[model samples]
Target: MPNAIPTTELYLIAMAIIFCVPYLIWRLGRTDYFAPLVVVQIVTGILLGPGVLGAIFPDYYQFVFTKDVIQSLNGLAWWAVMLFVWLAGIELDLGEAWKQRRESAVTAGMALGMPLVFGSLAALALIQFPGWIGEKAQSWQFVLGIGMAAAVTALPILVLLMEKMDILRTPLGQRILRYASLDDIAIWAVLAVVVMDWARLERQAIFIAAFVPACFLFRRFMTRLPERDRWYIALIWLAVVSFGADWCGLHYMVGAFLAGVVMDHHWFDRDKLDTLRHNVLLVMMPVFFLSTGLRTSWEVGGAVVFLAAGFLLAMQILGKQAGVHLAGRLLGWKRGEASVIGWLLQTKALIEIIFATVLLDKGIITSATFTALLLMALASTMLTVPIVTPKLQRMRELISRDA
Candidate 1:
């Protein structure tokens, strides 16, 4: 035992690997043009996962990701992701979407609806094969779950990319946020449906019934608290609600999003909120990314997974483009505007991964299906900046357009 490397040391080594590998590749390779640091981190995670690194270097993988070390990493990953999801919910700008109700409704509806339909069709085809569907999943659950994953837009990553491109505060940026905000709500609601446990129906009903009053009370209490106290109290609310949701078999993430959605973003200073998000991504999210990557598998064969990913990617891209273009025509949008919106709206990186994780956790999809969804997400996100940059360059006026 004296010759043993302590679990603490192993954990630190794992953390070091988690942060260093992605950072160096991103910095040295200058991949920010096509792949941002976040995307690189995600890809690095897949490389470090059991399917890749473990397959190549089983001893090293086992040493660094021993059960104890993985548990520690997973603990951090859960909390980090909860905070990230909470922030996304807090930043939802429903008021703006309402103000532009007619246009936002038409655009957000088509943007979300089309991919959903197409992706559902893809899912139906996927379920025709063995090893793609989860053991406990119903046919409907698997299809809807996969469909929803395809339609997801990673709002946080979208914000980061837009900020990097210097369009975050522009009129065009706000318009896109409005559309994404509406779609975000729909995505989670659909997830709640997909994960619903009939056996826990009573518990779920009770949770919802109590949550309404609790949300009202929490909002009232939050308004009276000082900003510093509000921050601390918000974390408490996040833990309580997330626990309650999980206890009711609805999943903790559903609670986390609800926790943030009820709380007003105006309670915290915008600058500080932005800083917290950046800090969380800087210090904690890589762990989440790494843990997520660890869940990837190729039990169904690597070729099959990639082909599935390719099919899902094509469906996602085509569906999103068709939806946005249809809306653009109906709304009388300027030429090329729908193309920019379509490509941007299709960036699925984090949220899609999160959705797939939920589906996998709930036994609605197999690990192979999860791997395919993850690849589809990475490809969609990486395509965003590269494709959108030139379009924006050509249509410089689109950046300033309010509608």
Candidate 2:
């Protein structure tokens, strides 16, 4: 036993696999056109996870991903995800959404609503079968959790995709951002409802009651600090708020998002903030992807899981397109414009995975459910650029449309 490799070495080995595998696939396979590096990392995480690697080579999987190594990785993944969610929160631009309230509200509402309905129906079907609902989850919780997962739009991923297509700064990109930003807020709001625990009602009440005044003071304090100090203080605030939320059973991620929402983006240099986000993704988020992959399971049967994913993917794509196309008819969008926007908005990469992780952590969804959702997210994201590029080509003017 004493001659065994140290846990530290094993952990480093796991880290090396997590980073190297995805980069090699993404670079050599040249999947950036269809699956960006981030998407490749996510898929790599799944392939490296227990269901694939562990099933194929049980001893090797266990040797590298020892309990200790996984624990260490989870610790890092927790902070990595919290920081990523925090950045997403800060990037929300409600002010611009307000300027185009009518159009934004209609589009965001329908876009979110249709998917919620379709996904909830899918969840209902899932729960009718065995192995989908979690033990601790109420019927309502499972339904709503899956529903919101389908409805979510990954704003940060959308930004990256749009930038790659040279539309991030264009008027069309700005409009899509506004719609997605609004939906982002709604996604968390619905999540708070899903995670609501009557047993912890008093604790959640206290957290909310305290959080408001604390946010006010935190904002005031942040305004007084110089840029250098503000960065340090913000991290401290994220930890404190996240702890409070988790302590009250609302989940630390809910706290992380709220921690970012109250702070003005102007507090930090935009370039510096962007760099931090990139660096976090570069250095830490791969661990999160791997950690997420580790959670994937086929206990319900692999075929069943894939079937569920396929059904959910159809619901997601159909729901999103139907909703946006309806909005286009109402608002007089040009021909094929809704197709471009609908496809763009349907890009769910990191955020949906994060949402599914929270559900699994809270026992609202089984690992089978999580695996299906993960597959659905991966498919949806990979389909975005390939499908949208041609649509954009056919309707170039839509790219320049401001309203």
The TM-score values for the models, in the order shown, are 0.98, 0.98
lDDT, candidate 2, 259-342, per-residue tens: 999989999999999999999999999999999999999998999999999999999889999999999999999899898999
Per-residue lDDT value at 327 in model 2: 93
Question: Model 2: how far is 357 from its true place, Å?
Answer: 0.5
Judged by lDDT, which candidate is best? Answer: 2
Error of 1 at 332 (Å): 0.5
Residue lDDT tens for model 1, 7-82: 9999999999999999999999999999999999999999999999999999889878999999999999999999
Kindly provide the TM-score of model 2 when superposed on the true structure, using C-alpha atoms: 0.98
